[model samples]
Target chain A: MELLEYGFMQRALLASLMVGLVAPAVGVFLVQRRLSLLGDGLGHVALTGVGVGVLTSSAPVGTALVAAVLGAVLIELVRARGRTSGDVALAVLFYGGIAGGVVLLSLAPRGQATNLDAYLFGAITTTTAADVAVFAVISGVVLAVVWLLGRRLYAVSDDEEYARAVGLPVLPLNIVLAALVASTVVLSMRVVGLLLISALMILPSAVAQLVGRSFRSTLYLACGVGVVVSVAGTAGSYYTGTPSGGTIVLLAIALFLVVTAGVALRDATARRRHGRQVEVHAAHPHEHGEGCGHRPVPHGDHVDYDHDGHLHAPHRTGTGTHYDEHDGSAHPPAAVVPPVGRERP
Target chain B: MTDPAIRLAGATIGYGDVAIVRDADLTVRRGEAVAVLGSNGSGKTTLSRGLLGLATVLGGTVEVLGAPVGRLRERGRVGYVPQRHTVSGAMPATVREVVGVGRLPRLGLFGRPGARDRAAVAEAVEAVGLADRLADPVAALSGGQQRRVLVARALAAEPELLVMDEPTAGVDAASQAALADVLARVSAAGTTLLVVTHETGPLAGVLTRAVVVDSGRLTYDGPLAGAGTAGPDCHHPDEAARPPVRGYRLDQPRPAPDAVRLRHGSR
Candidate 1:
């Protein structure tokens, strides 16, 4: 309880709370774009910024933000210029950033390397009011950009080519998104450290995807998960004398595992219930042939819905061999039927 | 007749400095439904993309709705459906939300969708016959259903000209029929269609003309039936409309074809 009495701890909690909400909120876009690890890349660049800060005796957070934003822009430019493949370019920057940071920090005064390490594993207890201000500004900007460009972001993320084809400025939108992600990484590194910051960005959204029904719902739930984890993990760390950053990351991961297990359990139960229904139909021959045409003539499309309101694969009998009785289409019968979650729109 | 919905005269379409489709000339008048047919690595997609400014016009002029392709500012008036691909895997959106993206161009800078946008999205979804699945996550739908959602997205824009790449490449007969049905309705309503595909199948009924592209050249540009007749001999009677295949010149090094690949990969 006395932890709250300390002004520094109060600052730390507020900063963590802001970082927690913003990281995953922006992280949703990263994950959707399959750029989940881009945060880690930007975080490495931010560490180099810290090294620059320590060498020049400037504000570490400010320098890190600059370095990260520049790195983000460079990456976008490289991808845009088509000088090299995206993965290759990102790989170069990812390693270059860390190596540069370590080398720079090593060349600095004796204690500066440890200060960089403080960024690697975070030093939340030392959070300053200035850090909280950075967090608030970063949060406001990230949230505002997301709100304003949310639909465009979704269209671009959904299919970049289609977005471009329809006249959305895909390149500019991409660079802006990268900048936002870079800012988020810098804002979060002070509370979660460079190494663990991406976890804050990616894990809550990953967990939310398992339970939330839609994209907007998942985003809402992800932010909720992040805030809960930040507050609860901060309290846990204060009480148990553990590192707050690692504790929060681990707690987020634990929540992900719990949600995954819950989804798996529910699916298994549904399958067993479906099996029972099939068996009951088998008991009475008349009930089977009408709607339960195990190998229905595939002349027309047949859609079967699962209890969860998702499409099920075409029904088949014990023969395990299905075919279109009349047309003899070249495509395999099962392949012709649409399976749940395999659509390519 | 009104000005063509799309026209490309002596256009060389490519990415950056490399040309994929060279000396291409084509036109589709308003309300015409034409299919661009080509094999893998052919330039059908490139030509369509060229009109949309996705593919760079290396030479000559390209126009859509009477505006230069590069400066075509009527964004909402031209709807484009790209090749079948996963929209989003990590963040699954409902069918409505996915279709709602079609309204983005109309919303403009600093504007949000209003009641009109909602009505358009709903109508588009209904047109695709997925009205029942409007609120369901697109990931839960079949591949055919997902493709329909994409069509719905394009339709929501209420574009005068719709350009689609491989709308039925991997789709089933049922879904293809449904797409053809919707496209028929769209065509009847005066929307021109430029569809790129290898096999017309169900779309055969709706296609008024077909342009065949082979090795970055227009081999045949005539009746839809002429596309099927395109063979090794390739004696397309319509010489004026057909661009001769400018086969590779051994003296000159071939332009690297990787630009299209790179562009697609980046996007």
Candidate 2:
């Protein structure tokens, strides 16, 4: 209640909420495509934009958005040409942007022009009401785009080659994806800064993926993680006098580690229980190559290999399919239709 | 009669200026189960990609379902099963979720899947005999099962034309038979099937015709029985001692990498 009374604190919280919610939606797509580092690369490019805006006395957000979008298009073009691998092109762009940013910042006049440290690590509590409005607008656009293209994006990220074969406009979709990612990275600078923006984008999805069962569930859970971490980390930073962005990212990493450990423990226990069940059921444990010489033991649609030499009944698992381990034969024959009567026969 | 389900005449498929398969002419009538057989880098996959608009049609015309390959927009009418290895390694999607994606083109950019999409997904999973494992994560499935999931995803689209690349490449013998069974049902349903595989194996039972590609050229296009095994022109021609047809083993140790680099284009 006390923190909410202050105008700056209210603005910071809203900014945190906006970035926290949108980043993971974009992050899930990136993670599924195994391009998680693209966020980080784009963040570096945004740094150059910030530098240019600082030197020109223009709004940093607009400059950063433009630069990042241009950088993303360049990256996509390089990838399309196939001359160099994607990572190689991204690396070149990332380092070049950062280097250009550093050179520009060093050349600018020192006092009151721009606080480079603020853009690097963020100053969440310093966000003004105008910044909150911008965050809201940007977040609104990101969410709408994602909502409309979510399924198609999932298909592309799941398998680009297949999506293309299905005639899903892979290149344009990819470009749109890059543009959205660029927008999110630019908007998130207020919450987590350029350096730590990718933390917001990637960590929640990684954690949610470890525990969530399905894609939709993983996406919702990731948003939940992002929101929870942002609130707790922002409040903790206020109380502890720490940098808000760094604290939030650290909290995310901690949550990720905790979830990972919990998943590992749960898997271990399940493995132990499974082992016990196998031991109880084993009259004979057939090794990989040591075929049972008998029919497969069907256990409710699953073929269980028993340690006992007793031959298991050859019951149909589904649609009269049975497997004999000795010769690797499946019943009902592999073909669905009657065998084609070849003219030669 | 309706036009062929797919036709590519004098099509040169490649990435840029370099053509992989030169002047490949292929046609598949409705209700036919055809396999485009070739060794690795022999341009069989490229040919399929060309038909699906994945590859650049350097020359000649490529059409699908009475539409140009590049302009055809009815995605639900054509289903594709890419190599299984690319489908599962990255995402954490479940078998049901992945299969549900098959319904996306039908759903459009903003459309949602209602009862019809769900039913299609269920039917596909059942057809592949993976109904019990619908909720299982795709990563948890074995390589063979993963391949089946890909097939189910394509089937969920209810496509009239199904194109699959190496459906049984790394699958075990039993799973291969099961896949064959599923493909048979798809073919029996009157869907045109284009299966690209190196060895006929279990598919030999159902494939009505075989179109062989050697060095980016159509070597044979005839009934499955008449198409002889991989010969001197097939992959690894250096290993002439290797038996052709049923004896060709995909799991065999690789020859030199350069030996299979006949096509210098997108995979």
Best by lDDT: 1
* lDDT (Cα, tens digit) per residue for candidate 2, span A305-337: 432453232323344433222122322112222
Model 2, residue pairs in steric clash: A283-A307, A283-A308, A284-A306, A284-A307, A284-A308, A285-A307
Q: Work out the TM-score per prediction.
A: 0.85, 0.85
TM-score of model 1 relative to the true fold? 0.85
Question: Residue B183 error for model 1, in Å?
Answer: 0.6
Candidate 1 RMSD computed on C-alpha atoms after optimal superposition onto the true structure? 6.9
Maximum-DockQ candidate: 1
User: What is the alpha-carbon lDDT of model 1 when measured against the actual structure?
Assistant: 0.77
Over 4 Å off, model 1 = A110-114, A279-345, B16-18, B230-267
- lDDT at position B252, candidate 1: 23
- For candidate 2, the docking band is acceptable
Chain A alone, TM-score per model: 0.84, 0.83
Error of 1 at B143 (Å): 1.5
